[model samples]
Target: MMETGQVRDFAVGIEDSAIEDLRRRLAHARLPEKETVEDWDQGIPLAYVEELTAYWRDEYDMRRVGTVLSQWPNHLIAIDGLDIHFLHIRSPEADATPLVMTHGWPGSVLEFADVIGPLTDPVAHGGKAEDAFHLVLPSLPGYGFSGKPEAPGWSVLKIAMAWRALMAALGYERFCAQGGDWGSAVTIAIGALAGENIDGDPCRGIHSNMVWVTPPDEVMANPTEEEQAGLDRIAWYRTKDHGYSTQQSTRPQTLGYALADSPVGQMAWIVEKFHGWSDCGGHPENVYSRDRLLDNVMLYWLTNSAASSARLYWESFNSGEMPQIHMPMGGSIFPKDILTPSRRWAEKTFRNIVYWNRLEQGGHFAAMERAELFVEELRAWQRAATG
Candidate 1:
C-alpha cells in the first residue's frame, strides 16, 4: 500500500531576474563555426541556431508560459519522500473514467495541455459525454516542476509505485494509464502491478505511443518487412543518433554543467531533437510554432532540471529489468517515431493488446503534435478498456 502526504497548490512564476539572466546568456552565447555538411548530419546549423537564439532573447515572452500553465489546476503532493507535481482535471460526466497521463523527458505537463479540454470535456470537443475522462497529468520525477529525487533508485518501477499512490490518494479506485517515451516505461511498470488496487487492479488498461517490446526468438529470426524496418531504425538510432542518450545514461552530470549554464546550449540540445525526431518535413517549424516549442524548452530552463531529468536515464536505462505487463495494453504507432515495432512483435510482450493502430501522421510527441488524434486514440482505448 502507498500513502500520500500533504498536497499544496503549485503555480508557475519564474523570477524576473532569472528571465533576464537567460536573455543575457543567450545574447552573449559563443558559437562554433558552421557544420561541414549543409544538412543536419552534423547537428543543427549555426546560422539557424543564431536566428533562434535571437528570437528567444529579443521576442519570446516568459510570462506567456506562466499564463498557459496557470490554465490548469496544478498541485504538488508529497509521495515517497518527494513532491510530485501534477495537473488534475475532473470531467463533468459523473462516471468518467480516471486517466493518468505521464510525460517523457524534455517534455512537461505542457505536452498534454491541448488534449485536457477535449478529454475532460468531450461534448464540447465533438464527442459524447461517455467519452469524458478525469485526466491526471504528472510531471515525471526530476522533470518539470516535480521535486527531483535526491538519491538514486527512482527508476520506472518506483515511479509506477508513486503513481499508484497518487491515484489512490486522489480516490481513483480504477483508472487507465497513457504515455510515450519514458512515460511508456512508467505506464508499463504500472500495468505490471495492475493487480494490486482497491478494485484489485491499479490500471484498467494502458496506452502508449512509443512501444518497447522484445520480440520472440522466432519472430526476430524471420521478421516481416515492417518489423525489419523497425529493427533497422532502432539500429540506425543506436549508431547515428544515440550520442545524447549515451551521455545522459552514463554521464549526465558532466553534460548537465553545459546545459545548466547556457540557455542557448539547452535550447539547441532540445530543439535539435524536435527537428530530428518529429515528423516535420525537414524542419520543426512545420509542426510547432516558435512560441509553443520555446514554452516546452523553458520548462527545462526555468527549473534547471537538465541534470535531474537526465538522471532518470542513468537510473533505469542500464537496469536491465524488463517488467512483465498482464493488464490490457493499447498502442498507436506513428510512422516517424524513433521506434515503431510491428503488432506481431509487440504482441509477444503485451499479451492482451486490445487496441493497436498505425497512424498516418504525427511523431514522437503525438499528444503535442496531433492533439486531436491523440485524444481520439485515448478515447478509443478507453472504450475498449470498458468492454
Candidate 2:
C-alpha cells in the first residue's frame, strides 16, 4: 500500500493507434441478425447499432473524450495499492462545501459532466454561491482510467473506506457523499461506518438517486399505491432486466471476453441499459446524444475494462444485509430507475432521512439524463442536512 496523500496530475490521452484500431474493428464488425421483434425487449436494435456505429466510425469526433474530460483538473492518487483517477474541481467560492460524487456501472465521471459547472460554480449557472461545492468525481476502481484491482476484496465497503481516505488526503476533514446504483451501496456504507469511528466523522452526510429498500413485512402486507408500484418495478427488474446482473455476478470473466474484444458488442451491451432505464420513450437518443453515449462507451472500450468492471458484481452483488445508516441521508427516487424505494421503505435503512422526493421524470442515469433536477436535489439535500 502507498500513502494516500501522494496525488499526481493525470490526463485523458488515448493514442492515435487505439483510435485507428477501433475504427478498423467497427468497419469489420460482425453484427448479429435483427431481433424478431421490432421493440427493445430483445435488446438494442440491430439497425440502430449499425446506424450508431456508422456515425461513430465516420463523424463522431475521436478527440471528444479528451476534450470533455480536460475541462476539469484530473488527478491520480494511490490508495490500497491502486491508482484511483479522479477529477478534483474546486468551486470559485472559497467557502463552498466539499462533496465527493460517485458513479456506478456502465456510467463514469462523464455522467456528471453537465452538472459539474453548475455545482462547482453556482453563480455562473444562475445559482447562489453558497450552493457551490468543491467537487471530487472519481472513476470507480476497475473503471475508466483507474487501475483495476489485482486481487479480490475490493468490495463496496472497501471502496467506501478508500473514498474516505481519498477525501481526507485532499484535506477535506469532512465532506458530503453522493451516488446512485452501486454508488448508493458505497455511500450507504460510508454513512454506516461513520458511526463506528472513534475520531470525528469524515462524511458529514450522504445522498443517493437510487435507493434499494425492502419494505417491512407489515408494510408489504398492505402496500400503498406508490409502494405497490415500486414493488412492481422491482419485480419487472428481477424478471425482465436482471439477466445482465446474473451474468456479471456469476461469470463476468466469461461475458467480458466478448465485450472486451468487440467494440460493437460493448456498445450494444451498455446502450441497451440507457434505453431501458432512461425516460426515453423507446430510444436512448431521446435522453442522450449519440456522441455522449459513445463517449461513455469509449471509456470501457478503450480501457479494455469489461472483465474487471463486471468483477465488481462478482465481488459485491450479494452484499448480504443492508447496514443501517444513522447519519443524515437523503434520497432522490427517480421513477424509471431500477429501484425506486419510497420514503417509507427507505426510512427502514436510512434512519435520519433529511430529504426525500420522487421526481416525475428522469431514470437511472439521473445526473446524465436530468442534470438540472439532479443538481437541485443535491442542493436541497445539502440545505436539509446542514439546516
RMSD of every candidate to native, in Å, equals 1.5, 1.4
TM-score of 1: 0.97
Q: Which lDDT tens digits does candidate 1 get at residues 282-311? A: 999999999998999999999999999999
lDDT of 2 by residue, 1-387 (tens): 225859999988989999999999999999889899989887888899999999999999988988999999999999978999999999999989999999999899999999999999999998898899999999899999999999999999899999999998999988999999888888888888877452478788999999867777766898899999988988998888999999999999999999988999999899999998999988899999999999999989989999999999999977788877788989998989998877888877878999999999999999999999999999999999877
Name the Cα RMSD for model 1: 1.5
42 in model 2: Cα distance from truth in Å? 1.1
Whole-structure CA lDDT of model 1: 0.88
Pairs in steric clash, model 2: none
Q: What range of 10 consecutive residues in model 1 has the weakest lDDT sum?
A: 194-203
Q: In model 1, which residue pairs have backbone atoms overlapping below 3 Å?
A: none
